[model samples]
Target: MDRIRDLASKKAAVIFTKSSCCMCYSIKQLFYELGASPAVHELDKEARGREMELALRGLGCSPTVPAVFIGGVYVGSATDIISLHVDGSLKQMLINAKAIWF
Candidate 1:
């Protein structure tokens, strides 16, 4: 969990994901489209992957891949991402976090 938090607080945005998850891919693409270079952690490829995922669950993230964080805060699961996007707050959120300049 400490490692995860360190990674999160390292940048404006972070995504803990699984490499093969389409949702993870979509999330990465979304940030790319918005010109934000988020730190992406493909947990499935990490040595402590399962441990990290479990730690995330303890942090209130969904029991799934694609856990997202902005400004060093845990945002939510995939649904929350879509909701933010639909509500038109995703862009502003990124901007406020210094994840995007334009």
Candidate 2:
């Protein structure tokens, strides 16, 4: 849990992902399209990945992968992010977090 929090806080925007998850890929692409250079942590490639995944679950991430954090805050999984995007709140959140400008 401590490790997860530490990694999540390292950047203005962070995504906890699994290498092969298509939704993870899409979420990453969305951030790129929005011009936010978010830090990506591929759980499958990390040494303590399973542990971290469990920690993410404890933090309320249902699908586990593609968990997002902005301004060191847990945002949610892919569906939540997509909803935020559709509502035009995601971009504003990115800007407020300093993940993107203008």
Candidate 3:
């Protein structure tokens, strides 16, 4: 949990993901398209991957692979992110976080 917090806070935008997860790939692509260079932690490629996955689950990420953090705060999973995008709020959030200037 502490590790997750540390990593999440180190970047303006952070995404916890697994390499093989399609939703993870989509979320990453969306952030890139929005011009936010998000910090992507591929849990499956980490030494402490399992531990981090469990920690993410504890933080309310049900599917967990596409957990997102913006401005050092837990934003939610891919579904939540998509909702924010659809509502035209995701871009604003990135701007506020300084992940994207425009």
Candidate 4:
């Protein structure tokens, strides 16, 4: 828990995205509304991004847009993020990931 928080605090949230992905945009907007300045990594722009995509696939996540990471935890796609917000679980997840206002 502390580790997750530390990572979130240190790195901000990492949102893996692609420029042409609508879900990515939604996720970014949602996070902004949640008061989180998430760092976006475009997975179609660099070699490292490709590596990240492969890694995510290896981790059992869908190889799609808007793969969000809070702290170091995989938080799934844009729809998943929105659901978390709707359920009021997004903030808690962020806190668990260490990305909350202390």
lDDT of 3 by residue, 2-102 (tens): 99999999999999999999999999999999999999999999999999999999888888889999999999999999999999999999999999995
lDDT of 2 by residue, 2-73 (tens): 998999899999999999999999999999999999999999999999999999999888999899999999
Residue runs of model 2 more than 4 Å from their true location after superposition: none
Off by over 4 Å in 4: 1-10
Which window of ten consecutive residues has the lowest lDDT sum in model 4? 1-10
Error of 1 at 89 (Å): 0.5
Q: Clashing residue pairs in candidate 4, if any?
A: 5-98
All models: lDDT?
Answer: 0.91, 0.96, 0.96, 0.73
TM-score of each: 0.95, 0.98, 0.98, 0.78
Q: Residue-wise lDDT of candidate 4 within 18-85, one digit each (tens)?
A: 88888888888888877788877777885666766776676666755777878776778777888889
Screening candidate 2 with a backbone cut-off below 3 angstroms (N, C-alpha, C), the clashing residue pairs are none
Report backbone clashes per prediction: 0, 0, 0, 1
lDDT of 4 at 67: 78
Task: Answer with 3 or 4, whichever has the higher lDDT.
Answer: 3
In what order do the candidates fall by TM-score, top score first? Answer: 3, 2, 1, 4
Segments in model 3 whose C-alpha atoms lie over 4 Å from true places: none
